[model samples]
Target: MERPLKGSAPNADDEQLLRGRVYGRDHDDPDPGPLPHQTYAALVGGPLDGLLLDITGWRTEEVDDGVALITELGRWPGGRALYDPRSGEPRTPGPGVSCRFYYSGDTP
Candidate 1:
């Protein structure tokens, strides 16, 4: 009955459902469902900020998606998720690089 608002704020009903998920109340159930845009409202909050979630080992395409996710953050106000440099790769920009997921690959 409750769910996160599509591409928008977490509605009152959606918040209730998220609360349950955050506390691991109904976690065993499959399909935690579509994730929240900012990863916070989908029961996926701050823990990731300190973890190693880089695309260093992923294929180029995967890297592109990751970068795009960060770039698109500017498109949505109040969105505050950042991918930290856990792998020690310098996040330098190359000329003509599209705003997509890309691994630094320790090539800097």
Candidate 2:
């Protein structure tokens, strides 16, 4: 999904795309649309860059602390992708991307 420009409201097309798409829904379940007040952690850089992480039930501290995500880059089976919360302006790589993480080698 394309990140909307910072400070820019989502256009009609954006809303249309989000329609009928439910986050974390099982493949077998019918589409029930997104949950209310849904929020996400936009990953920047690394193998999972440009991906939106579901932070629906996460606390403020958890979002601030960032997370170690599982990835398939570098490692044949799997590895951990470390990410950190971004601070200050000019740090966000793009719109909706509040966290920035770099490729610092994969961790098993």
Candidate 3:
């Protein structure tokens, strides 16, 4: 199946394209975000409506049916938001402490 953008619902045209153009298609302009990395394997084995997501570039309450929403920003490359802050197990990557920091584009 063709995958859609992360954190957002699939559009009708994209769904149709996935069904229609699974075979060889010509390449176009490059994608906007960094290609998905190995750290993107955390979302699995559950319905995704209420999962705590924390990856970069995802809108809050974003929904996707093709793949699980990414829920971990890389704090230390191999480490992720799932790493527990206290018990050292995989905890949900909720919002970080509300801190005043410099930002470039948009604020969440």
Candidate 4:
């Protein structure tokens, strides 16, 4: 995915591309934020999304259906927004968050 230039807007094609992407998080994890330095995993479907963080040493792999984006979330002692703030549960990475993408089969 491409970020629009400052003060510029995305054209119709960019909008359509974004619409075809999918994102998900671990529903079983109860922590709102990942424990400092702990490994975390999220689900990615459809086309792969772009990186928000240039975190090094991240890994990705193919799954049975979609893809698995795995990374070790760096420590956040205060418990940051890595997870849903409202519910403190793992969920799809949204704005301002970062996740790595891995693919083995077809994607959007």
Highest TM-score model number? 2
What residue pairs are clashing in model 1? 63-101, 63-102, 64-101, 67-101
Q: For each candidate, what TM-score against the reference?
A: 0.21, 0.50, 0.18, 0.19
**Model 3: per-residue Cα lDDT over 17-56, one tens digit each:** 3231111222242432123331121222121221222343
lDDT, candidate 1, 1-108, per-residue tens: 543333444455544444433222343557543233312211123311111232223454454344212211122433434332233433433222112222221110
Pick by TM-score: 2 or 4, better one: 2
- Candidate 3 — number of clashing residue pairs? 0
lDDT of each: 0.31, 0.51, 0.26, 0.31
Task: Locate the minimum summed-lDDT window of 10 residues in model 1.
Answer: 99-108
What clash pairs does model 2 have?
Answer: none
Candidate 2: tens digits of C-alpha lDDT, residues 18-108 = 3344323443466544444555565555555545666666666786677777644424225576777755423332234344444343466
Instruction: Give the RMSD in angstroms, all C-alphas superposed, for model 2.
Output: 10.8
Candidate 1's C-alpha runs over 4 A off are: 2-6, 23-108
Candidate 4: stretches off by over 4 Å: 1-4, 23-108
Candidate numbers sorted by TM-score from highest down: 2, 1, 4, 3
Q: Which candidate leads the pack in lDDT? A: 2
Please report, as a residue range, the 10-residue window in candidate 3 with the lowest summed lDDT: 98-107
Give residue 104's lDDT in candidate 4 (0 to 100): 35
